[model samples]
Target: MKQPLLDMRGIVKSFSGVRALNGVSIQLEKGEVLSVCGENGSGKSTLMKVLSGVWPFASYEGEIFFEGSQVKASSIRDTEVLGIVIIHQELALVKELSVLENIFLGNELGSFARLDDEAMYRRTSELLARVKLDVLPDTLVRDLGVGQQQLVEIAKALNKNVKLLILDEPTSSLTSTEIEILLNIVSELKAQGIACIYISHKLDEVLSLSDWVAVIRDGEHIATKAAADLTQNDIIGMMVGRQLDELFPREVHDIGEVILRVSHATAMQAGASRPQVDDVSFKLHQGEILGIAGLIGSGRTELMQCLYGCYDGQYSVNIELEGKEKAIRSQRTALQAGIAMVPEDRKRHGIVPIMSVGRNITLSVLDNYKALFGAIDEDKESQDIDDYIARLKVKTASADLAIKNLSGGNQQKAIIAKCLLTHPKILILDEPTRGIDVGAKYEIYKLMFALVKEGVSIIMVSSELPEVIGISDRVLVMHEGKLKGDFGYRGLTQEIIMNCAIKEGA
Candidate 1:
């Protein structure tokens, strides 16, 4: 039998005396794609970190054998020198740098004396061609879209002469077209005898692309099976330790009077030829979960930003809030009118990472805790923060800890708690469950139902079609800055939503 390309045995890791990976083992055959999947805190990333030398040889208990040799790597560069490259969930490229500069940032293409620009550009051009990215070598990273940035990341990895590539949630921010391109690249890499370790919460992608599927739960390896023999439900069962009969836990809520109405809303960029959102009109009902579904750049986010008064572009929105027409000129105006929005980019726009968990949750509604002489009431603030921490089930060692210290799901919950503390009549969530695990997603879904039951309206904008079809009471589809279709979720399917989103005309 041929030796496995990578073998990690008896791997164990911990943080603060708590075990993150307990006796976990994984193997990858030469040129094979092994997918590691689990819930948010299930230790998948920890295992990869151990292999990539992020935890180092002494920090974790494990025996890593690469290419029939026991390897002890003390740093990320150590593993990279051994042909192991890791692309983290967050892209590592510098946005201000050009493509060629970012790709060769650490590994320069010249001797210690001088930099070789021409040689680096030629090599970068070849890498970009291999990855099918059609952009100039001098293009700034910031100018490229998220999908393009991901391709750039891959190109950078290819320059490292990688024998095994580890991708963590690589497609979480990519669109359908970009995902297809990335999967094709993986296949090509496999054909060239390069091994890959793919980690993602998207099960369909896992089952479709993997040769072997490994499930880890609670720091333990649940099972590893051939992809052909396992079904999506089987994988989900192993990840959560229970059969998820229905991915969406639908609950019927009483739909009441119209709580919000936007008529002839339009948002225009300063130098663009056309408006980002063009003459869109929609009505949101009380106790309703209204889902906005569309492809990327279809103006769904722009419409929401305009409604929330956060769009920098020229825009006009005539809104009726609780049967009274109001003009919202800024985010403060929108908040004063009882409208709250959870932005799409959580790290950039949602939470204050350096702030404490409690502070982030109560940031939007601090005025509620103010007492005599404009002094804040510590007792009331603590009470409200504790209430939300328990109510939303945000996992943290303490409320005083920095919000960024928590996992993605817990951080998301904290952001939601922040939005809820404002007591808004209308809550707008842009991709509420994006980048979170399935377990956390279910919890968020249940929370949505509870909120709607209490008469709070929700407007969710999501790129995931299944999520839009699953949890939404009604869905509005947009294509090319136009509302193409609006339908109830009773008989809706993903195909219907996509058809509307891709249709040529209004």
Candidate 2:
């Protein structure tokens, strides 16, 4: 019989008065991957925080035994020193720095004297090779797309000679080919006796890669079983403590007249290599979810940006709303025309982190509630904010609390709530659930269904294939600034979409 590499017993954690983890236990064998599967706010991340020392020894009650020795990790550095590394839900690479610099950040070698440029780049190349990423070591982090940046993060962790690697939603942004490469890397790591704690909302990934599956729900451990032993329904039942009827509940609804029409819309940067978004035309019908699916760098985002009037691009547009032609030269114009856009980068573009939750929600609709004398409407504003907070299940101490205090899921919900108040006819959600957890994703899906039922046309651009397939009535696949394929929801498959996205002949 072989000894286990990692063992956590009687783990308990809390935030203020709310218990996040209660008496959870897990075990991992050397060279095996143990997947943690749970809904959002289910304490999977909290348990990982405890193990990685984000919640220090004194803050959480737990016993972590690594390599048959009891260890109390007081800081992230302490855990790192023991060859344990965590790649957080939000990536930690310094955008301004080069790849080599980011990989060696805080964990720099040849430290006391100065940085060893030659040695660092050499090691970085080796690590990159292991991960199947062939980019130059000196490339800036900011220049890379989300998927490429994720590979860089993996390379950074591997550069630490990590024994136990923890990945949170690692493949969320990756393409299918990239996911294959990552899975191969994980298998290679396993061959070398390295262990992994894979945390993800992606069940297929968890089932495919894991040897054991641990389920947690509402701060308590439900069960841990072999990956092959549990059915998909079995896992879901454990996570939510009930059955999820449909991942994409596409209830039949009538598609009315075109609510939005964009003709020959173009967005271009001055003196750049061709326009960011070339001449494009599309129409969205009321009560319809039109999903835009494309690889990163496709013109999908730029088209949405143009529709929302987010930039002063060399722009020429013909747009129609509700049978009337309208000009949207600015964000104000777009908002006035009953269009709302949820930007892709929620933290930077979609939210005001330092602002109070109430203020952030009311920002888009301030004029409607303003007093006739131009005085502020404090009481009404507070009430509206509170109403949204309750409706969206936004977890906040109070409406007055800063937006930065909420978790990623809660923040995303707040953003949706903010947009909902605008009474938008056409809602543009660009990567709406990019960094959100599964439970939050379910909530967003339900919200979308409800909105569609209410006759609000939605244009959603998503990198997630399952999401696009599940929720959309129709999908548009883009390639190299062009629409490559268009299909009704029932007619699309992962294989068909992939072929269209990469097929130059198409």
User: Best lDDT goes to which candidate?
Assistant: 1
Residue-level lDDT for 248 in candidate 1: 84
Model 1 shows how many backbone clashes? Answer: 0
lDDT of 1 by residue, 260-284 (tens): 9999988888889888898999999
For model 2, residues 411-473, the per-residue Cα lDDT tens digits are 888898899889999999988887665656777888888899899999999988989999999
Give Cα-based local distance difference scores for all models. Answer: 0.90, 0.85
Clashing residue pairs found in predicted model 1: none
| Residue 504 shift from truth in candidate 2, angstroms | 1.6
TM-score of 2: 0.92
Q: For candidate 1, what is the lDDT?
A: 0.90
TM-score of each: 0.95, 0.92
